[model samples]
Target chain A: MEVIITKDLEKIYNPDTVPVHAVNGISTSFEAGEFTAIVGPSGCGKTTFLNLIGGLEAPTQGDISILGDSISTKKKSEMTDFRLHNIGFVFQAYNLIPVMSAYENVAFIMELLNRPQAEIKDRVMELLDAMGVGDKAHQRPHQLSGGQQQRVAVARALASKPKFILADEPTANLDSHATETLLDLMLKMNEKEGTTIIFSTHDIRVMNKARRLVKMDDGKIVENGKPDTA
Target chain B: MIAKLAWRNVWRNKVRSLVVIIATTLGISGALFIAALISGMMDKWVQNQIETELSDIQIHQEDFVIEEDQKFFFEKEDLERQLTAFANEIKEKAYRIKAEGLAMSAHNTYQVILLGVDPDQEPKVTNISNYIREGAYFKEPGRIKQILISQKLADELKVRMNSKVVINLSDIEGEIVGEAFKVVGIFKTSSGIFDESHVFVKNDEFAKVLKMKPGQYHELAIRTGEEVEVEAFQTELQQGLDADLMAESWIQMSPALKMTEGYMDTFNWILLSVVLTALIFGIINTMLMVVLERTREIGMLRSLGLNDRKVGLMFILETIYLSITGAIVGNILSFFLINYFGNKGIHFESWEEGFEAYGLQAVIYPILELNFYVLVTLLVFFTGLLASYFPVRKAIRLDISTAIRN
Candidate 1:
C-alpha cells in the first residue's frame, strides 16, 4: 500500500528579494515499507520536499497525503499532532537533546504523549536493545562516541513506533564507521518493524543502503531509479 | 514532559540559565525582604500606639476640643446614670481617667495628663494605679492638697513632696484662677516619654483646682471585655450619648500609625515594579538568544512534531522553574538575612532627636513570620509569570519554515 504520496508538490525559496523556485511541481508516491532516498547537494529542495511530506510546512501549490490524509488541510497544531502520531524523524545534526541520557531522549516523545511510566521504560529499553546499545542507554550524548550518539538518535526516532521516518542527512555528522553503524541500525529497524524510511543524503554509502534513489538539482528532479550502479 | 525537557535544556546551557536565575533570585529576595520589613514595621507601630497605651475607647464633648470650649464639657449633669453604668468602673480596678489640662505652679507651667479617680475605683477600668512608683495616693481630705508629678517635671521645678506650689486653673468663662498645693507623690512608667510630661491628681481636687464643678472630666479611658467589640461600642456610644458627644477608638486617634501603613503599601509596589522589570529583560535576553542559536534545532523539534503550544510551554516552564527555584532559594537566603536584621534592628538615630514631639522612639526593629513568606512567594510568582509571557508568545508564534530555513 502507498503510505506516503505527494501531488505537484512545490516550495518557493527567497520569495522576498528574488523569488527562487526551491521545489517545483512534482508528484510521487512511496509504498508502506520501502527505504527511499531523495539525493541532492545543498539547496536542491530535497529538504523542502521532505518537510512538506512530513507536514512541517505547507506547499505553495500542491498536496502531500500521508496514509491517504491530506496534510495541507490540517491546522498547524493538528499537523504537529499528526506528525507526532505518525512520523518519526532523524536530522543531519543527530539532534540528541544534549542534557538527557540516551534513555530519556528515547522516551521523550512517549512522555509527551503522556504514556504510563512503566510503558515508556519498557519501550525505551526495547528500542535500545534492538539498536544494539542497550548498555549505553543511561549515557548522555556528549559522553558517547559519534556513532553511539547516532545509534541512540535512531533508537529515539523509533521510540514512538511511528509508521514512517524521515532522515535529513542522518549520516552527515558521522565518521565512516559511525555512518555505517547508523545506516545498518536504521535498515535493521526497517526490516524488523516494517517502518518505512526516507532520507536525503549525497553520500554514496547512504545511497547504496536505500532500495531506491531519486536524484535532484536546482529545485528539479533530474533522475529517478534504482541505485543501480548497484 | 515539557518541564523535564526544559529543565534539561536549561542545564545544557548552564551559564545562561544561571544568569537568568541569579537575576530572578535577586529580584525576588530584594522585593520580598523589603516587603517583610515594611509589613513588620507597620505591625509594630500599630501595637505600640494602639493596644499598648490607648485602651480602644475615649469619650469627649462634641465641640469641646475645637472650640477650646470648656463649657461643653462633661459635668455633674452630663454624668447620667446610663453613662455611669457604661463606665462600669472600679477605682484601682481595670480602668482609669485621662483628663487633659494645663498644669501650673509658680516655678513653671506645662501641659499635663491629669487623671481623676476614687484611688479606690481607679483600677477597675484603667492601668494608672499600676503605673505609679512613689507615695501612695492621698486619702484624707486634709491631704487633699497633695499631688503627684513626674520626676522629670520635679527636676525642672526643683520641688518635692510637701513643697508648696501655686496651682492655677482656667474656668469655662476663660477666667484664670489660682490655688496652692503641695506635691505628695511621684508617678513613673517604663515608656519614659509619657513619664516626663504628666502629673496625677484626684478627680475632685482636679475639678476644684480648675474651678470646675464636680463630676466633670475631659474623657473617660475604659477597658472593655474584648477588642473586637470596639467598633460596635463606638456606634452604641454615638447613638447613646447626648449631642456634642463623640467616642474614638485608638486606631482612629493615631494618624501617625495610619500614615506608616500607607507608606509601607506604596514602598512595596515601587520595589516590586523595579524588580519585575529587571527579571523580564533578563529572561527575554536569555531565552530569545537560545532560539537564535538553535534556529536549526527548533526546526528539528518542529519536524519531530513538537507543536506551537508545546514549544511555548517548554520555554515558559523553563522560565517559571528558574523563577520559582530562585524564589525558593532567595527566600531561604533572605530568611536568614531578615531574621538577623530583625534581631539587630535597624536603628533610627535620625528620627530620635527629630521626632520627639510625636512621642515616637527612633529605633525600628520588626519581627518576621510565615505569612511574610507566603506573601512574598505569591508576589514573585506573579512577577515571574508576567516576565515570561512575551518570550513564550514569540516561541509559540514561530514559523517553522522561516526558523528551519535560517
Candidate 2:
C-alpha cells in the first residue's frame, strides 16, 4: 500500500521578488517497505522535494498525504505533532545534540513521544546494537567517529517507530569507508524490519544501493524505474 | 531530563555564565549592604535622639508646646501625682525648668535653650553626665551656681573648663533677667544642633533667680524600659493628667525621625530596583547570547517535536538556576559581612562632623531585618524569570528550518 502520496507538489523561493521554482508539479507515490532514492544534480531540487514531503516546509501549491491523511492543510503546530508521530528524519550533518550522550540522543525522541522508560531503553539499546554502535551509546557525538555518529542518528530516527524515514544527503559528509558502513547499516534496517526508507541524494553509491530510483532535473522528475539486478 | 539539559547548558560557556553569576552576586550583595548601612545609620540617629535628648516620653503644658513662654509651667505637685500613678511603668523621670535665652561669652553670643534640672535626677533620665568631655556635672562639690555647656557652644564662645558665661532670659513674671554662671562642664554629643543650642543649669538656682513658686516646672521627661509600650503609656498618661497638660511619645515629639523610620522600606525597595535593573539587563544579554549560539541545536530540538513551551521552559530554567545560585552565594556572603560589621561597626571618624550634623554617631552598626533578606531572595527569583522572558520569546519564535540551516 502507498504510505505517502504527493500531488502537484511545488515550492518556490523568493516567490514575489525573483520567483525561483524549486519543486514544480510533481506527482508521486511511495509504497510501504520500499527503499527508494530520489537522485539529481546539486540544484535539481532533490532536497526541497524531500523537505516538502517530510512536512518540514509548506508547499506553495499542492497536497501531500502520509498514510492517507492530507498534511498540507494542517496548521504548523498540528503538522509538527503529525511529523513527530509519523515521519523520522536523518540530516546530512548527523545533528545529534552535543550535550547528550549517544543513548540520550536516540532516547530523546522516544521520551518526546512519552514512551515508557523500560521500552524506550530496550528499543534504544536494540537499535544501537543493530547499527553496530551499541558500545558507543554512552559517549557524546564528538567522541564517536563520523560513521558511528551517523549510525546513532539513524538509531534516533527509528526510535519513534515512524511509518518511514526521510534522509537528506545522509552520507554527504562521510568518507568513502564511513559512507559504505552507514549505507550498509541503513539497508540492513530496511530489509530486516520491513521499514520504508526514502533518501534524496546526488551520490551514485546511494542510487546504486536503492531498489528503485526516481531521477529529477530542474525541479521535474525525468525518470522513475526499478534498478536491474543483472 | 529537560531540567538536566538546561542545567548543563548553563555551564556550557563557563566564562559567559560566570560573568552573569558574578554580576548578579555583586548586585545583590551590594544593594543589601547599602541597605544595611542606611538602616544602621538611622538606628544610631534614633538611639542618640532618644538617649541624649527626647527619652521615651515627655509632658508639657498644652500651651507650652505651642508657646515656649516660661509662664506655661505646670505645678510640680500635679506632675508628681501623674508620675506616681504610672510608677510601675516608669524607669526614670526628671522635671526640668526650660527657657529660651541667649548665652553670651567674651567672644560670642548665640541663642540657646536653657535647661534647669535637678542634677541627680537628670542623670537618671538622660546620658548628659556620660557625654561630658571636660569639667564635671552640676552636682560636683565645688561647682555651685554652675552650668554644663556643650563643646560646640564652648568652641563658638571660645570658653573652656571653668569659664563664666551669662544666660539672659525672661523670668516667670515676664521680666527679662540675666544670670552669670560658671561653665563647670563641657559635653559633646552626636547631635551638632543639640550641642550648639542647649545648656544645663541647677534647677534650684534657676528657680531662686526666677522667683518661681515651689513645685513648678516647665517640662517632664520620662524614660520607660519597655520601649514598645511608650506610645500606649503616653496615651494612658494623657488620659490621667489634668486637662491643661499633654503627654507625647518621642515619635510625636520628632516628626522627622518618625518619617525616616517609616520610609526605610521604600528606600530599600528603590535601591533594590536600581540594582536589579542593571542585573536584569546583564542576565538578558547572557541568555540571549546562549540562545543565539545554540540556534541550530534549538532548531534541531524543535524539529524533533519539542514544542515551543518546552523550549521556552528550558531557557527559563537555565536563567532561574543561574539566579538562584547567585542569590544563595550572595546572601551567604552578605550575612557574613553584615554580622561582622554589625558587631565591629563601620566607623566614619573622618566624617564625624557630617554625621553629627544629622544627629548620627560616627560608628554605624550595619543592620538588616530578617524579612528584608527573605524579600531579596524572592525578588532575585522573580528577577530571573523576568530577565529570561525576552530571550525565551526569541528562542520560541525561531523558524525551525532556517535555524537548522544556520
Candidate 3:
C-alpha cells in the first residue's frame, strides 16, 4: 500500500520579492516497506520535498496525503499531532537532545505520544538493541561517537512506530565505514520490520543502496527509476 | 522527564547559570538587609522619643495640649487619686507644671518650654536624670530655685553650671511673672530640637511664685511597665479619669511617629520592588540566552512531536529552578548576616551628631519580622515566573523548520 502521496507539490521561498522556487512541481508516491532515495545536488529541492512530506514545512501550493489523510490543509497543531503519530524524521546533523541520555532520547517521542511506560521501555530497548547501541543507552549524545548518535536518532525516530521515516542527508557527517553500517541497519529494519524509509541525499553511496532512486536538479525531477547497475 | 531535562539544561553552561544565581542572591540579600537596617533605625528612634520625651501615657486638662496655657492646669489631687487606685499597673508618675516662657541669661535670651517637675519623681517617670551633661541634677541645696537647662540652650545663653537665669512666664491667673533660678545642671538628649527648646525646674518652686495651689498641675506623665498594653492602659485611664481630663498613649500624643511607623512597610516594599526590577532583567537576559543557544535543539524537539506547550514548560521550569535556588541561598545568607549584625549592632559613631539631630541612636540593631523573609521568598519566586514569560514566548513561537536549519 502507498504510505505517502504528493500531487503537484510546490514550495516557493520569498515568493513576493526576489522569489526563489525551491520546489516547482513534484508528484510521487511511496509504497509501504520501500527503501527509496531522493537524490539531488545542493539547492535542488530534495530536502524541501522531504520536509513537505514530513509536514515540517508548509507548501506554497500543493496537496500531500499520508495513508489517505490530506496533511497539507492541517493546522499547525493538528499537523504536529499527526506527525507525532504518523511521521518520523532523522536529520543530517544527528539531532539528539544533548541533555538527554541515549535511552531517554529514544523514549522521548513515545512519551509525547502518551504511550504506556512499560511498552515504551520495551520498544525503546528493542530498537536500541537492533541498532547495535543497546549498551550505550545511558550515555549522552556528547559521550557517544558520531555514528552511535545517529543510530540513537534512528531509534528515536522509529520509537513511535510511524508509517514512514524521512531522513535528510542522514549520513552526511559519517565516515564511510559508519555510513555503510548505518545504511545496513536501516535496510535490515526495512526488510525485517516492513518499515518504509525515504531519505534525501547527495551521497552516491546512499543512492547505490536505495532500492528505488528519484533524481532532481534545479527544483525539478530529471529521472525516477532503479539505478542502471541494479 | 521534562523537569529532569530542564534541570540538566540549567547547568549546561555552569558559568552562565552561576552568574544568574549569584546576581539573584545578591539582589535578594541586599533588599532584605537595607529593609532591616531602616526598620532597626526607626525602632530605635521611636524608643528614644518615648524614653526621653513622651512617657507611656500622659494626662492633662482637655485643653492643655491644644492651648499650652498656664491657666489650663488640672487639679493634681485627681491625678494622685488615680495613681493610688492603679498603683499596681503604674511604674512611676510625675506631675508637671508646663508653660511657654522666655529664659534670659547675662548674655542671651531664648524662647523655651518651661517644664517644672518634682526632681525625685521625674527621674523615675522619664529618666531625665540620666541625660545630665554637666554639673549636678537639681542637687544644689538652697532656698534659691535650681533649674536644668539643655546643653544646647546653655551654649546659646552662654550660661554655665551655677549661672543665674531668669524665667519669665504667665501665672495661672494670666499675670506675667518672672523668677530667677540658678542653672544647676546641663542635659543633652538625642533630639537637638528638644534639647534647645525645653528647660526643667522644681515644680513646687515655680508653682509657689505662680501662686498655683498644691493640687493644681499642668500635666501628669505616667510610665507603665506593660509596654505592649499601653493602649489598653490608656483606655482604662480614660474611662476612670474625670471628663475634663484626657489620657493619651505616646502614639496618640505624637502623630508623626505613628505615621512613620505606618509608612515603614510601604517603604520596604518599594525598596524590594526596585531590587526585584533589577533581578527581573538579569533573569530575563540569562533565560533568553539559554533559549537562543538551544534553538536547534528546541526545533528538533518540536519536529519530534513535542508541542509548543511542553517546550515552553521546559524553559519555565528551568527558570523557576534557578530563581528558587538563588532565593533559598540568599535568604539563608541574609538571616545569618542579620543575626550577626543584630547582636553586635551597626555603629555609626562618626555620624552621631547627624543621628542625634533626628532623635536616632548612634548604634542600631537590625531587626526584621519573620513575615519579611516570607515576602522576599514570594517576591523572588513570582519574579522568576514573570521573568521567564518573554523568553518562553520566544521559544514556543520559533519556526521549527527554520530553527532546525539554523
| Top TM-score prediction, candidate number | 2
* iRMSD per prediction, in order: 1.6, 1.2, 0.8
RMSD over all Cα atoms, model 2: 2.8
- Evaluated on chain A only, model 2 obtains a TM-score of 0.97
TM-score of each: 0.86, 0.92, 0.89
**For candidate 3, lDDT tens digit of each residue in A1-230?**
98888898899999899998899888888999999999989999988888899898999998999999999899988988888998889999999999889999999988887899999999999999999999999999999999999999999989988888999999999999999999999998888778899999989988999999989987778888887633
Pairs in steric clash, model 2: B76-B215
Report the candidate with higher DockQ, 1 versus 2: 1
lDDT per residue, candidate 2, B329-364, as tens digits? 888888889999999999999999998888889999
Q: Could you give the DockQ of candidate 1?
A: 0.70
True contacts kept of each: 0.78, 0.44, 0.71
For model 3, which pairs clash? B76-B215
The candidate that wins on DockQ is 1
Write the residue-wise lDDT of candidate 1 on B13-109 in tens digits.
7887787777777777777778877776666656555433565676677676566555566753664544654654312122223445656656777
Backbone clash tally for model 3?
A: 1
> Once model 3 is optimally superposed onto the true structure by TM-score, how far is the C-alpha of residue A159 displaced, in angstroms?
2.5
Error of 3 at B110 (Å): 3.1
Model 1 chain A: weakest 10-residue lDDT segment is A221-230
If you superpose only chain B onto the true chain B, what TM-score does each candidate give? 0.75, 0.93, 0.90
- Lowest lDDT 10-mer window, candidate 3 chain A? A221-230
